[model samples]
Target: MSESTLTSGAPITQLPDDYMQNPHEVHHMLRAEGPVREVRTPQGLKVWFVTRYDEVKTALTAPGISKKLMGRVRHDALTEHMVFMDPPHHTRLRKLVTKPFTARRVEALRPRVEEIAAELIAKLDDGDVVDLLDVFAVPLPVAVISELLGIPIDNRDEFRAWSNQLINVSTPDEVQAATSGMADLLYRHVREVQAAEPDDTFFSALVHATESGDRLTTEELVSMAFLLLVAGHETTVNLIGNAVFQLLRNPDQLQVLKDRPELIPASTDEFLRLEGSINIASFRYTTEPLELGGVTVPAGELLMVSLLAANRDPERYEDPDRLDVTRPVQGHLAFGHGIHFCLGAPLARLEFDVALTQLLARFPNLELAAEPETLVWRDSTLVRGLHTLPVRLA
Candidate 1:
């Protein structure tokens, strides 16, 4: 094993070289050792990695922990969103957009979501080997979110590239470039929407949305748009991708879903529990010294909650590693817990249900095109998904 020195001059353990490809083994080791372990991320940042389910919930909701960036990392347009804010600020920002993502609103979007999924699936042909991630997973959510936000569809490819760089383990330079590019594009788009007549689109409503006569500022709108556009699609993209990948790997589980299509909605939680999109929750820091999983972490230290690890914790679920579509999953940290729980959860679930239902019905014999061991996972601590999910649509 290798070590790296943090800015505090303390030695930190580096993650295994193959950590991204297969993190479960490492997570199993970490959970057994203890809930919290200090380690260096693939990007070379040191963090207190929370592995077990119980400790993860504590880290997420503890009053002493903070989401405020506070200059710990470079601040830019991306940092302006509610995910980085705490309390009153987070509350206010979330309130403005909450109505649009409510269960009723999301359910109302079902037909449109189904239409988009069907349109994408129609492009594929039987007996064709294709990168499912590229042709299906990525575009479906991108199109849905783009239309909802009233953003033009012409720049989706650019949006995907920028979002990938921002979400993945990129250097400061890469992140800055992506941040600048996305900020520029969204700023212009937001301005266009702001100047136009009020409309029913979510972005327009957000621009015109008022809570007690309060509205999002220009910078805030850009940041919120950035969050919605990127996160709005990214999570669902991986959710669909990971679900299909897991189903392909486990034939028995796949057959269960094929035989009982009604299980698809319930299976969404199982897929999320097994391999939800985001690996680690976003960056969080300690406000003061606090005990986490019996380990005392100092103030001003970085902490990361492993959503991926927490969901598969043996103590939390029986046979956690096994992919059982019928498993009753509840309180999984896949969508996170507490105030920062994903606002897009409802939409993501709806999209998964539509995507998988149409997908399986249209291509009942779908199978993986590549060997299981050969697939590559994205090199990202924040996002957990594949670089490509090659599959045969038969």
Candidate 2:
């Protein structure tokens, strides 16, 4: 490994390629050694990487840490989402939008979600190879979000294109341009909806909140819209893609699911645990000097809990490498933990359940078109997913 350039103690800044490809090995090392370790970024930022399961649970619930540390460390223009906020403010912000993400709300969309799944499946031509990620996985979530938010059918493509640019790691200027473009789109769309009569949709709800005594600022509304578009779709897209890839990799397990469909819900959790979409926990900054697992992380420092690493820690899970669809998964940080737990968990679960159930039932003989090793992984430090999932419905 390269010489430790940033933090004290063992060399930790640079994560090995294997860590990105499959971090189980390094995670084992962390569990055996310690939970919280001082790591340095290539940019020389001193950050803490929480590795063990219990330690992560504590850190996630710990006071004085949150997703609101944006611009404090890296002043990126893409940090407008509510995921980057702390308590009272975060709670207030979340309340305005929480209703739409509740289980009942997501469940109410079942008919539409099932219809979208069927529509996508119906479009598949027999014996033709398809990039499932692009055609099936990606569009499903975007369409669902568009329908729920009442985004005009014509505007969905623009929202998607802008969201992709905003999330993809690009140059500062490019990131800024993407963020500005997304903000402009959301501001304009919300304003137009507000100027007109309110409709029965999420954007309308936010407008109603504003019209009432809720007091949601224009910037906050835009930020929430940005969050729904990016975080809402981006993570679910990865989850569906990852779960499909895992099932295909283990045809026996796939056959089992195909044979017995009742296991879809339980299998979804296992799929998330084995092939979690969000690799990194949302960003958190220390409010005070915090010591975890014997390492001291100073106040006002940036820290990233590796959900990818934590879930695979041998101390918490047995046979961490195995992808048994039947395995009972608990305490999985896939959706996250604590007050900042994913608000869209219910909706995500519904999408996965509906999408996966239909996907397997429709294309029972689905197989990867390319070798597993040949498939390109998305080059993202934040999310774990493939750039493309090429498959053929056999």
Highest TM-score scorer: 1
Q: Which segments of model 1 are wrong by more than 4 Å?
A: 1-12
Counting clashing residue pairs in each candidate, in order, gives 0, 0
Pick by lDDT: which candidate is best?
1
Note the residue pairs that clash in candidate 2: none
* TM value for model 1: 0.96
Across 1-394, the per-residue lDDT of candidate 2 in tens digits comes to: 2337443345664666445566556666666767887665444456788888777887888886767777564553346556787777877877777754566667888899999999998999758899998889989999888777666546656666666555544567766677777767677877777688866666686666642357566677667777776777888899999999988898899988998999998888888888788877767888888878777788887887888877887778898878888888888998888778887778888898999999888888999999998886765657888888999986
Q: Please give, for residues 29-109, the per-residue lDDT of candidate 1 as tens digits.
A: 889978888898766677899999999989999999999873356677667888899998999999987855567767888
The 10-residue segment of model 1 with minimum total lDDT is 69-78
Name the lDDT value of residue 189 in candidate 1: 92
